[model samples]
Target chain A: MTIYLPIAELSVNIFVILGMGAAVGFLSGMFGVGGGFLITPLLIFYNVPPVVAVATGANQVVASSVSGAISHFRRGTLDIKLGLMLLAGGLAGATVGIWIFSFLRRLGQLDLVISLLYVIFLGFVGGLMLIESINAIRKTRKGVVPVKAPGQHPWIHRLPFKMRFKKSKIYLSVIPVIGIGFGIGVLTSVMGVGGGFIMVPAMIYLLRVPTNVVVGTSLFQIIFTTAYTTVVQAATNYSVDIVLAFILMVAGVVGAQYGVRVGQKLRGEQLRALLALLVLAVGIRLALQLVITPADVYSLAIGGVHG
Target chain B: MKRALLATLTLLGLVAASPAPAFAQALSPPAQGSVVERLEIGMNTSQIAITPDFAGADLAIFGAVVNADELLNSIGQYDIVVTLEGPKDFATVRRKERVFGIWINRHSVTFKEAPMSYTLSSTRKIEGEPGVPPLDAPGIGIQHIDLTPTDFLRGGRLLEDFRDAYRRLKMESGLYQPDPGGVRFISSTLFQANLKLPANIPSGTHTVRAALFKSGKFIMEKTLPLRVVKTGLEQAITDAAHQQPLLYGMASVFLALLTGWGASVLFRRD
Candidate 1:
């Protein structure tokens, strides 16, 4: 039941890893989000080396994103133009992220920085999602019909160099789209997440792209960004474990299929609320670890002696 | 002169009894002592091939002491201590401090040469036993392992704390084990011990040392070589990653894309 991971240099139960992959995959499929944020932290909790967890998590994202993107493409919901624009920025951002990752690793601050980033981002995103979902649910319970807003936000309209995305039926400035992609790309490399949760909301609210196209467009861009991250981590850090990635991907794909079916039976507000709670729980746990006094204050790492 | 002759005779007896032909070549010249001692060691296996499914391994180190006179044997004063040490490597130990209400690594000490894994086993309690000499003085326990910091002068009491912390962590991780009473004597001259190599054991040549103590004093010591290596798929993957990292990286990306595409096509419903 236990298998040895060559890159991670540890033994883990096969079923445990498979279950983790399936659970995260199911959530991602249901929510239209890449589950890297969940999977990476779970792996770290299971004592997988942090470097291996982050790198391999990105590799798994490549698979899920590719599958999700293709599905959207076939359904004619993908915004190819928007996806490509975001990808350009994502690629550039990922390169910078990798450099920062290496610098922090050399200083032995990579784990601390990673945990801190997770706590901050997850808390903010989760809190926002929870509040928004609760309000939407209350409105529906009060028998108030939901209304859709027309036109872009005032801030978005003020941006220069607007371009039309025919697929999403929108005209937006390239600067903000590229900036959003760049931010997602950095997250992909550094945090091993596809940044779908952030990207989906940004597209719906900030860019004012149609809700129907947001998930597809986000998945499309994530495929390339995460693929690039996987390669860079493998080459530069030698941290990616192909075996671990492959196993997780296989289970994740199967889980995603079941998740899609389950998602159809659930209401959007309920699903969002659940996901928000999950994210908040993980974030709070990580934050608590930082604030709590550790039983042992010392940690060891393999490297040359440094004064 | 008589003691040296007896030691030579005992060495010849050991060479004749040893199963491994290479053991003869590894022996050093006999040390000067009032009573000469002879050691012969045998391992369950000399080479441990770490296959893909290798969870861990248990090794039995059984050996014998020869050339003891009747007077020494009657007193029953001999003790056996065995240590298995993995390849030497540098390790950095960092201490965390609360800064602005968040714990963060503030200072670190580096050990110049530390074993990746070390297991110590003794026939009797190594330290703090009634009427027994402290093992630290004789370098017989895990605490007594010669660990020197890179910047020895800079680290004063802090260096000692780091060293203790490092040992504690290693012990918790099962990489450093100090097992008193792990060794047992089948008879006065024959002794055996068991030590486990954790699944995360580093792959390299490991040194197995056995020392014989007489009347709370060091008498003689012997060393055996053991090899731990990755085999088959584990070796292939590790070698590829280290040697052809770029190619390996490309392959990983390509594989992910192919699998993703294949899964989508295979599961497509329409």
Candidate 2:
């Protein structure tokens, strides 16, 4: 069945959209990662206009983050103070990012910028995850626990404007927290991603945020950031299609449920390895499009009417 | 002042009408015939309401050729070419070039006041052919549609390539369609011209035009105003997004919140 997307102004196969949502949702659930990184790229591949895909992806992340955050809040695994700080930065960053988004769009280079950012970020993150997971798998086979040595009194400890996060049990500088949040906020606006894939590792390793509280904190900030992005994108760009977003959200949540169940049966290191490969695959695919010659060089955009 | 041609049109296309005849004059010099051959078209409705599931629709333009010569009618000398031109807008076409091993849009040309969509239905191939009167001239067929660059001379001499690319792309996108045999002659005086409204047809005040040709010579033409309006949920959504954008944005966020919260609550019960 074909359904018309109001904002995108395109008719797409309903099953194709539903399947994409379900598949991305399952992976996010299984991998414990927000699926923004996957869904935005997938939507672009499906020929959804980049503007619509980006805004809709941000909207999808809002739902997933809300659910993910709720679980963490129930378990008391989140640092509210830290998450709020991140949000403050995220809100400001998102505001700036929208300006950049519109500017790039007017320049007609928004699509190129989106693809380049995705290729760079996804490639870096995927390669790091692959190497780390492979090492972890090797360590487990050798009967050694792969425990990371916690660094104390690191350079981050000397930064000014330091505040204590009681829940995370860390006295971290507000600068890095806000900075990371700001970066994620910009990503949410431009790329329509929750930034959890990057934020999770940053929280765990760079900020030295506790593992238990990291996912919850990241998700807490994500819910608001993506929500804000959605609202702003609609207000400015008017690119968010509620019809498209709703389908993806419903299918994604249902798929995530099954994914969580399957995730329980898989080992941690292997799961990360598989997810890494998936991320790498998506990243590489986007990269190829940039280098390869396109079928049609001349493209048209009707100005002032969805131009 | 272009010319006071005795053509029939409700809207002006560089056509000034005299008291005797009004509007829709072709590019050709006004035909001075002993008997004025006039074309008339009637629309069932002024507006076509498109539903959310509107893929594409066929608009049947029923018209009559008034005062046509009997000899011309008997010998198939009269050819009718009908077209539906969509609302006009500035359409920009961009060309991509490989830069530093990556292809990017490097050049662009915008057609000023170009019709957003166009569908042509004619009695036969308009390009002059044997046994049939050719109506394809400076202002008749799809190829004859007027398209000028915004910066006509600034692009220097490379504007023609952009124009060609624009037409090819539009045709490929199913926006510019030509049906040579779409218009059929039910009778000599009366004809039914079937124009296909593409799935992506722009909603606006479209013009239904019928140009009459007698023995390959241009006569008076006729035009009618047909509004294409998107209706139902699709229209409602588009309106809300543009009109009450803030409210629409809030509603979208609220919906997402509800969906997310509901999912979390449902899963918790399980």
Candidate 3:
């Protein structure tokens, strides 16, 4: 059956949207990633307006993050204090990001900027993940346990505004933590992603947060950042389609439960390798689109006349 | 302007004075010697309510041609063309250029006012026939439609290219459809046609025009007004989003938070 989306002003098959939501949700649950990076592109492929897709994708991320965060909270793995600090930075970054988005939109360069950002960020993150996972897998096969370094680098130690995070049992300068949060916030606002992929690694490598708490903390901050983005996009751009978001979130929530169960049976390196492949695959597809000539060189867009 | 106003008033007075039966008879072709032909048209529905489940709509236009000359009727040369045009809106077309190995929008042209969607159906092929009136003769096909560029870009050398691009893109999106032989005649005087509206048809007031031609020459034309509007939940949501965007945005955020919190609560494990 087909249903018309009000804000997007398009008719889409119910089953197709549901399936898309479930599939992305499952990956998000298993990998502890926001999946907006996946959903936004898929929506674009399905011909949803780019603005609507990004806004609605951010709305969906809020639901999945909440669902994932609750479980981690119950397990006592969340760093609430750290998450709040990161959220403060993220909010400020999102504001600046939205301003930039508006300026780019006025200049009719939003689509190009968004596509280029996706290609660059996805390529970098996906490439790094693929290499690390492959190396970890090779080490396991050779019967060698990987060792982690504990001490902070000189630059990180020298930063001002140091604070202690009790849950992760770490003392770190707030400057870098806020900077990371700000970067993720900008990405979340522009790309409609939860930025967990970047956040998890930053927390692990830079801040030396406990691996077990990283996912929870990232999710905790993501829920707020995405929520803010959703509201801002809706108010300023009027692009958020609540019905589309609702359908995706409902299916995503259920799929996430199943994903968590399945994740328990998989080895860490194997899961990471699989996720790395998925990320790289998406990144390559985006890169190829940039290089290949489009079927129609000319495109039409509705003028920016606010209703 | 005064003369036009007087003419319109006189026409309205004639309509008001005529009875229902007289009005019907008045539309018939003029007696024997007159070269004029009379056309009467009706639509299945004048207003289309777009609900949440609305995929698309098929519009049926039925009409009759009265007093077509014997020469035209015998030769099977009478043609009927029906067109439906949506409200005009500003549109922008952009061409992408390869810059630094990445495609970026380089050139753009903006149309001041263009139909958001247009559908045309004709009894016979609109083009490629000798002596047949061109589709854009006056009030016929899309070619005849007046598309003006924005004031700043008017009279530019590249105007034709931009117009062609706009038409091409609209066609690709199924917003502009021109189907030949779409209208069929049941008998000499009576004809009907169906216009298929795409799922993405914009909501607005549309004008439907039916024109009659004899021996490849335009004779008479009639226009009907139509309304395509969103109804029910779809209407409500769109209105809120556009009219009260701030409140709508806040509600959307609140709803998301509530849904997330509710899901967590429901699925929480002790």
Question: Pick by DockQ: which candidate is best?
Answer: 1
Model 1 reaches what TM-score against the true structure? Answer: 0.86
Task: Give candidate 3's total backbone clashes.
Answer: 0
Summarize candidate 3's per-residue lDDT along B1-270 as a digit string, tens digits: 553454345435445555555643433333343346679999999998887788999999999986555444656767889999989888888787898988767887777678889999998777747765554337467765666766554466677877888887888888899998889988767899899988888888999999887656677899999998888898899999989988887787777666766766776643
Model 3: share of true interface contacts reproduced: 0.60
Cα-based TM-score, every candidate: 0.86, 0.84, 0.86
In terms of docking quality, how is candidate 3 classified? Answer: acceptable
Worst 10 residues of 3 chain B by lDDT: B24-33
lDDT of 2 by residue, B122-230 (tens): 8888886785445645577767778777764546557878888888988987889989888888987899998888776778799998888766677778889999887
DockQ class, candidate 2:
acceptable
Q: Chain A vs. true chain A, TM-score per candidate? A: 0.83, 0.80, 0.85
Q: Which digits, one per residue and each the tens of the lDDT, describe model 3 over residues A123-231?
A: 7877776787688788889998968643447799898899999988988889988898888777766655677777776776678786557767877887787777787
Off by over 4 Å in 3: A100-121, A150-152, A189-194, A262-275, A305-307, B1-33, B130-133, B151-158, B265-270
Return the lDDT, model 1, position A286: 77
- What is the descending DockQ order? 1, 3, 2
Residues A1-307 of candidate 1 have per-residue lDDT tens digits of 8888888877778889899878876765565677777889889878787778888888887776676667667767689999999889888887787677767778776668787987998899889878877887888899987786534477877799999999899887899999988887777666656777777766765787755566668777877777777777888888888888888887776676555546545566666677678778768977987999988899888755554
Question: In candidate 2 chain A, where is summed lDDT lowest over 10 consecutive residues?
Answer: A146-155
**Per-residue lDDT of B1-270 in model 1, one digit per residue for the tens?**
564476456656655655468842314333344336677888999998887787888889999887764344455666788989989989888898998899988888888778989988887777757766644336667888778888757567888899899999889888899888888888767889888888888888999998887655677788899998887787788888888888887887787777777777877853
**Number of clashes recorded per candidate:** 0, 0, 0
TM-score for candidate 2, residues paired by index: 0.84
